[model samples]
Target chain A: MVRLSLAMILCLLMVTSGCGKAPSESSSKIKSQDPASVQNKGTIGFSALTLTNPFFKVIADNMQEEAAKHGYELIVLSAERDVKKQADHVDEFLVKGVSAIILNPCDSNGIGPAIKKANDKGVPVFTNDIKYDGDEGKVVCHVATDNYQGGKLAGEAMVKLLGDSGGKVAILHFPQAESCQLRVKGFHEIVNAHNGKTKNAKIEVVATLDGGGVRDEGFKGTKDVIESNPDLAAIFAINDPSALGARAALEAAGKADQVTIIAFDGQQIGKQAILEGKILCDPIQFPDQIGKVTIEQIIKYFNGDDVKTEILIPSKLHYKEDAEKDPLLKG
Target chain B: MIFMLLLLVILFSVLTVKQQHPTGANAGDQVGKTILAQYGKGARVLVVTRDTEEDRGFAQAAIDRLKAAGADVLGQVNGSAIDARKTIESILAEGQTIDAIAANDVTAKWTVYDRFPSVGSAKCVTPKPYMWPNFLKLSNLMSVANQTAIYAIIAIGMTMVIITAGIDLSVGSLVALASVSSAIFIRDYCGGTEASVTMVVLGAFVGIGICAAAGAFNGLMVTAFQIPPFIVTLGMMMMASGLSFRLAEGRSIPELPSAFFWLGRGQTFGLPNPVLLMIVLYLLAHFVMSRMVFGRYIYSIGGNEEAARLSGVPVKRVLLAVYMICGALAGLGGIMLTSQLSAGDPKFGLMYELEVIAAVVVGGTSLMGGQGKIFGTLIGAFIIAVIKNGMNLTDVDPFNQKIVLGAVLTAAVLIDRLKRHA
Candidate 1:
């Protein structure tokens, strides 16, 4: 009896919720698109790792525009880093009879079965940013930034900055992400090689702590390293957010002028920071390019063309000079 | 709760109505029949379809029907558009004129025919799509059930725990611990993919055993030392989560034996293993909660612990058993999730503690103590699952989906409060 009353109240409230669903054309009808509008080749479904991050939102927006130009519609959904929820999205895409499915897999291994399910249904799967490392599923193509190359650029910047006078350095790392691991690895290789040649100007390696690739951890980690190494010359953070976090930590400790921070991922904020001389420089990634190129590959796959299994977009280093002339940061 | 579930069913069904494309042998038969009616018997036909289970059925049925109708079936290409293009190019080179191209909706939409004007999409006959709610589809329904099975399984234990004025926040972390430990056991000790079924089963038990130990520790803290259940389980949650990450070295253990996959992915009696397991566990839980003496003791303690203790009820024992059972079921849920996703990662059960607790609260389970049914939790699980599934089907904004879920949970609690007052 209690449940019945609960049901009645819920019905009244949720009815409005259901009705407020935006009217979208009943898609994936299998029939040809209406002869009036652009004959949509097919709908493409994208299950992003998450859309809360502007990084993925950029990719989704670009993909939508690019797909529309090619006469295809894009249905973008965020899995919020839940592999099971991503799997459910794949199932829905399959039931909708979409042309292709794309994802930034939450878990490289755990998302295997979900991709495999799409493969069984004859729908091709593509990945961006995060690669599916598991062997169970087949992804037609993966489009992502070259993180290692970006890290190498960061290393070059570091060597240029601290190679003249040897100074102590700390690393704020996010080890869980494979991309970050590659970045740190590349950074280490360059630093080690630079140290091998110049003993007089050796940049002594200092504390390496996990920054969780986010602001709070980055701030805390930076605080810890500065306390231990008061003469810390520089901090190399994996991404823009963490770099900003390190800046905050340094400011809090009144050592903002003492430590130079080099971060990867030249997002708008990061570029603005470089312009303001907060960060030294950053290796910028083109999320827009990743999104556009992914659509091109999807077109090629459906157009009876051989598509490359992996496409890596290289990152470029941006200095304060470039940030001054950057179009994206102007407004 | 059942009435709410039924209403949700009707709500989603009405909202998600759309044209569903025909597939399988029936789709093939429809296409073949259309071809026969168009060009009549003695017509030469070519078939094109992608390589999939449904396409396979469609190809077989279409070929069978065309041949039975005395139509001259040419060649069938069951693969990508490239394969179809290759076949069509060769057929043209061989001077074979195709009268009709039998295809499904997917193949019919292909642009391969545009290259050969003589054999264009105009000559293709596809099965007509029928209007139906996507929610009502058998596959979608099964997926909803399969998706909810893990949560429902854990909710059974949570129901009991919540009934005793206690919360078990560690269930989510215990799930991850079980998944990673069980996976690691199989990969390292059982020879990975080459392990026998027995070895894999043993690995799973090892995973469960560790979580059970954690739960017992929680029970010990709560009963022996007089700690709050919240604080005890909360501490356990972090420790279990940290331990899993340390054991896994912050990487997913994907090298588990295939024999272990049967627990999560395999189906029994046409239902997924997790869903079937949920049903069986719920029945057992229902029996124990209502029909057993120990069940009465639990209720007596929850109803009034000091009074029940004076009346000779073993309060401490019952509470300890409840926490242990909660932990064990969480372990089971972890294993089931590992099987379902085909790998166990430290990232598997993020935020699942709140999800389960929401299920318990929505099922009319009171946080104050000693009320709620085993079956009520099941309905609550289904309610959450249906909302999620419906939102996905309707293409409602994912952000809005979160808002709706929060609203539903809040409403359920509010309604429960109102009912008590009334």
Candidate 2:
């Protein structure tokens, strides 16, 4: 009887809560928004993979700035690299009746459902930094770095450093990410082409290790590679953290001066590494531009204008010589 | 029981706060029309969050805005993402159509792709296979089994410790230390080459040996100094974790031989080796706990320590032996985990002790000691694994998943208490 009564009360409570407020009270609160001064522009939501990553944070800030300029209220949420959390953020946006949503997908495939939900709701969705695996038409646009181009630039720089007498090289990479895979593809293709044409210039990839895209994994993987391949001439790290890890391992082995290191992601540490001559050069991405472009696409969508489906923001090469001159290298 | 009732009341109040005072009847239609103007008349919004005061506030605000916008506010669910999805499923089961859902981005993404299959692109890409059908697949079953197997192995020892009215909080840390030590030994002495049968066995022994030594040290400290088991084990936990970190030098040891992985990831006759090993260990634990004299002594000691001592039971020796056995099991668990990940990370087995302990407790082991079953602990481990697998398959929000898990555990204990009283 006690359990039954408790359950009954719970049911009653749930029903009452579901239909608690009348239309007049909520409508009155809604009228508080002055229709005269403020343009009733729709709200735009952004779901970032994580704000802890300075790159993503910069993009989010830029998107906010761009949204304000377009007279739209921006709502930013961080997924903290969890796909489930990102999905929830999208749901929240849909509930708030946001005009559009910008996503930095934690996983391309995992974001399919969220994109589908927005598509059904007629709320345009845009992806920044990563592409979602849903229907092509579902997403209004994808704003991201041209990672393949960045890799090509890195490879070209390596060729210049090698000076047509290329030696054995080690590649530290995170193979799981599509962006990283593209970077590796570009780097490998360029190096292979260079080797095939140039006599006496053979850039043999002695080892390819998975750095798991983190400093600790990079450090450990590099240490293992260095132990196995002491004759390594150069190391190409897919990102700044991996390069830093390799640098630490090389320093520990007292062979830091022997190998030329090139990395992607012109992070603060990587730039310092370049200035310190530890790293040859880094390919830096324009995250702020990506964020601004994402919002621009959303505005275009709202204006019933055709928005390009894909936008590749080019990455720049940051060298030790340019560190002092280029504000981009200031991290 | 009182605490359980109080918690339920608090949960009820929090859930019903918005419903306590309904707005004017005419206000509902006005707000609904407003929502229709913004979105559409057919728009249905479902709001969800983890059951917390703060999350509820967010849900309420969204509900208010949704109401103001003239949207058909379906309801607010304060539970796991899986629970929210289940609610949607039930609503759909009753033939009620849902148009939209509101949640934090993570939960929203997972629920939409996982639950509302008709609307989204059919192809849902996830790092791990999360389809509901996949949960029943042999490979996924094996994956779940593999996870449960490790926890069950560790929980076997934890059950023993709890049976004696003692706790071993350092088992997780011990697993890390053992794994790191074995990895280092294998790399240095065995050439870190492809796993041969001999190398795998040698590595296992080395890892288990290190864990046993650590366990012995814990036992000696607890028995010799007459220190509380909690304090002793807690100290051991930190010391073992520090040792693991120091040995690995803040890096993971990867590239273990294929033979080593065979113990973790390998299948024999469609069953993972780890699952097989877990079953064998459980059988052994069952025998030791139910049929052996040592087990009887442990029970007596826990039931009445003074009486057991007066009855000439070598309490110190038995306690020491029990701890060593627990350590050995933890060592074995570590070796298997290392083989599974193909890496011995110092950060491996982080907070795993809590899970193992929870498994033991949920299996009906009393903290005050004196009663428990190895089979029950095994079931407890599987329960946890199943919950996790189900949540993943259903695309439950990870944060909300934690809440659901906590609630289930509490309810389990409460049910056990009610049974005791009845």
Candidate 3:
């Protein structure tokens, strides 16, 4: 028991350390373009939806690191998750004379005016994570993972674990993130397609719960699902943290083996769970890579290079066997 | 109180006509030049100013800046006497495209500010005009409801305790702890099948029960140890926060049941449920404080604790109940917050106690232990919310929002103080 606890602590420390240095090292490797060689003379301003979310932090950190390596400064501002604040931030960036801007907009529509302003400024803008409802010419690029595809894979994994017999499966979700909505769509579609996959595995997508993406919420959300669905076959979480929390509740109630758990976001803890055979599988997203891609596109645009408007970064689907093989999850 | 209201009316009147100028976005020669990057020879600008050489020179300076930047100065409004309606009407009569409007040396009043006709596709920028209706709006009202509900829940209970000459510093931290606990429960039980709702209710009750126990513990500390309620609750606040973090491992709980979400998101007849809950609670509190004999005991205790005890009031029991009630309300707030976010996070509602205290004090509740009303607190919350929401609509920066909240809080308190003196 002592050895196991020590192993877990060491693993968590390694993950934390890896997170801190990956960006700075990655950016340092990218050769800095000479200012004299700067045929692409323009600024790129990167504004995030909020600085509060650690998810956004990982993306922003990577973008800044890569941009710095390319000898370009990424003007970063936190909109604090307010749509209006994001709009104002965009407008301010526009007024500052940027060549192009990368926006992780807080709202789908509130950012339209700022987009227009940037358009008027003759600076190309790219959106990440969120899709904007505006003219294609107004935006230069939109890069994001196929959240729906990832969610479908999660559903498939759940069905495989539960078999052709259908049972109740509760989903812990976030309403604010459109990505979650896409995931829900995919999960429902995939589950419906798999008839008789289990003897009685009639997939009931229970309440679309909002965990607000917090741990205590994860715990509470999982506990609620379990209590509400006594015969629940499996739980599908939007993210790994929620999955870990659900695991905690299941352990507490001594129902650990009875219910299968599947989740999105191949976070470190989720990887640990998969390796231990506690969870079915987790679909991993490369947020840092997404950030790097966005930065690269901005740099390319500044260099008079035409880049694709949409960039799709692939997700890694990891089962227990795959997770155990990964060096990041190795002892 | 009457004098304060009278002064507000007077202040409102004086502030309205005292200063008038287009402070918000209005296209002018300067704005046109900035936007166009070169003054258009045929561009129109509406300049609002006093009919004096100095005022005209300022307007001209702006015009020159615009022209140099690339815009034509087309029109001007020289009002020697300030009349918002008449002033705006005169500007429209000029037949110039209102490219940008700039207010010079004028206080913006709410009544005259709202009278400006459609800006006609021109960008308008001006100092925010203070309007009563804008101050009392839906968005602003919602923000106030959120901010006020955070503080008022605890404050109402604190008022009852303080009226009995007791203090509860722990109420703040207790609120945080309870919120964290509730957040944890709701996050776990929120998305399940039919039982999810039942699970969430159970979690809420358990979380509240934990808070009530914390309150009861406070009562026991004071009663058993003969310790001051102030010291006891203050100590509890620190310990509670520590316990919450230990339980949560510094993680925030996010997911929660939709039913609880309704507490934060639900609206009846265009008002947020949290605000509606606050009103209902306030009314209930008012009734309990004014109509019940317990209310009389509380006031008597505040006026003279020893005398109330001598007069046959169960002073110790009342004190304990008061603290317990305060704790429970704090727990209720935590639960409501859980509903709002649909998550249980131990770290949630941290430092919210201060805001609650501020609302209580600002609501004309005497911190000296007795004088206050639930209705006054509701108004206090409104005032804070108006400043925040109004600032948001006017495009004030977030940092500025804090400064504005501080200023409004101070002003409200000052107004109350003045009333006392008057």
Candidate 4:
């Protein structure tokens, strides 16, 4: 147990050190373009949806590192999914006279006045992960993962696993989430297209159950579906937690190998699940890239460059092979 | 409670010491003076400012001072870094060399000057930033009051309800209901964006009236049916939240007229409208609690309901009024929130009932219902706001902030319990 703990610590240290240099190096490489403006720029304020989520945390960390390289300070605050709190953070940012402001808006529409406030102050507002589509405030740029494409990738992974002889499938869905909806839509498009191409071996979606985008709900939904349909071919979960939950339910029902799972969000746990052969694979989002790109846009905006209104970072499929190479998971 | 509020104010003020950038006319005039000193008469100057009212004031002052002092005003960029970049590009293209760029402090931070080699950032003249605590800034103080006004206003009703030995968990949901109702009233009945001032005011009253009805229902249940206030309010909380979602179709209503924003965002006498409204409501509530017959009856019922009835006090009516007032104020909070955020969301007022109750309790108001002060609740609300703002200014960890807030609430309650025991 002691050895395992030590090994984990070492692995974590390696991962942190490896990641710490990446954003700075890349930012420096970008800074090579404008070597003249290398002195102290100013401060950038970021209010995240919640830092409790490792996704937002990663984004904040990468942004801080990247901003430091370009001689800027990043002040991060967690809004805890409260729009009022996020608005207050924006107000505080304005009060502090920040050079730029970034937000993962708690409410796309409710956050409009706060964005308008920043815009009025001439502080550039950027968003990531959560896009603000309100008509009131102007967002200089938005950087986020392409959830639809990630979903399509998940669907393609489904086909690759069972394209030869497809059977019955179930979907663990969270319809309320816009990103999840896009994922399911992309998955459906790909699966339906695959079915249309081959008549003999068709994948039939027998059950589409609400998993609440959470592990406990996913576990219960999977258990109920397994009881009704014992010959289920596969399950497509909108995210990692639900996928892992489905795997646990399948194992509990003594049908681990009988069913396969394809998930989105290659969170550390999801990768570990793939490495352990509990879940198949995941289409991962690049929160790190989102953070880096957001800072890049802010720098360019300050540098008198016209930035794109929206930037979508592409998601990558992570199989067991990629998980094995991950330093955080290595002994 | 006032001491607590004062202490927090001082603490946050000290912690938030930062460089305060100058804007508006005076700073612009200062920058103009500096430009004149460095570059003598007829020095070509480009006036750069953000397109805000304050920045425009700065630009006006700078342009006036520079032109009056015989310096040539090349042009002005009343917009973004990109706009300033374009203006400078055009200026350079016109074969005109700028002796200086007159801009406000915020405008001076823009790295757009780096793009212009001849007119580097050094050529820009801005008023020097003064060192000051952010907490003490008039703008920050106004914002703190404005944000706290919602909780402070709602706490008045909560304080009265608790004073009468009753609780209202439904105020939070009522806030949402009111927000949704007002937004829908303006959008569907009144002409949304084209809504008149009279119609907008009427829409706000409509929102408050609905919550008042709900509050009246809560009072009826407690007074007539003899149900516990906690149980009744808990049930109402769920029902109102669900009803609001149903009415709103689970989406926020952002179609209200810009004039409607005056209540939440407008200022009077250099103070936020909500803060002014909170001050007025607190004054009225204090009067009712201290000088009025209704206030006396409320105290009697809270102190001893059976004894109050024996003493010819109208217990039921007072109770009903108290609940209704609580609901109405919560509705007002919802309206203020809608105006502040410029949207009426069913998700508005999330956990606000608890927040107001906390303020009431923290302000040294006993939950046992017979002893509390209206002003105490105000101080309590400010205390919470100060802590939150101070924590944000200090860059405290978000998770740790929750722990700190939890500790403060616990400590306040514990102190209350100990004081009661003593």
What TM-score against the true chain A does chain A of each candidate get?
0.91, 0.87, 0.78, 0.87
Over the stretch B208-264, how does candidate 3's per-residue lDDT look in tens digits? 888888998898888778898878888898998898877766555544445656665
Which candidate has the top score in DockQ? 1
lDDT string, candidate 2, B227-289, tens digits: 998999999999999999899886667646667778876788878799999988899889988
Better of 1 and 3 by TM-score: 1
- Model 1 alpha-carbon miss at residue B45, Å: 3.1
Listed in order, each prediction's TM-score against the native is 0.93, 0.49, 0.45, 0.88
> Model 3, A190-307: lDDT tens per residue?
8877754444557777666776555678789888878877877888888888778888888988889888888888777778888988778987788899899998877665333557
The residue-level lDDT of candidate 2 at A73 comes to 60
- Which candidate wins on TM-score? 1
Error of 1 at A308 (Å): 1.3
lDDT of 4 at A146: 92
Tell me model 1's lDDT, rounded to 2 decimals.
0.87
- Clashing residue pairs for model 1: none
User: lDDT per residue, candidate 4, A159-185, as tens digits?
Assistant: 998899989999999976678888889
Q: Specify the poorest-scoring 10-residue window by lDDT in model 2 chain B.
A: B121-130
* A238-318: candidate 2 lDDT, tens digit per residue: 999888988898999999989889999987778888988889999888888898888877765543345688999889898
Worst 10 residues of 4 chain A by lDDT: A1-10
Q: TM-score of chain B only, all predictions?
A: 0.97, 0.68, 0.64, 0.92
- How many pairs collide in each candidate, listed in order? 0, 38, 66, 1
Candidate 4 lDDT over residue span B362-384, tens digit each: 88788887888888898888888
- Alpha-carbon error at B279 in model 4, in Å? 2.1
The TM-score measured for candidate 3 stands at 0.45
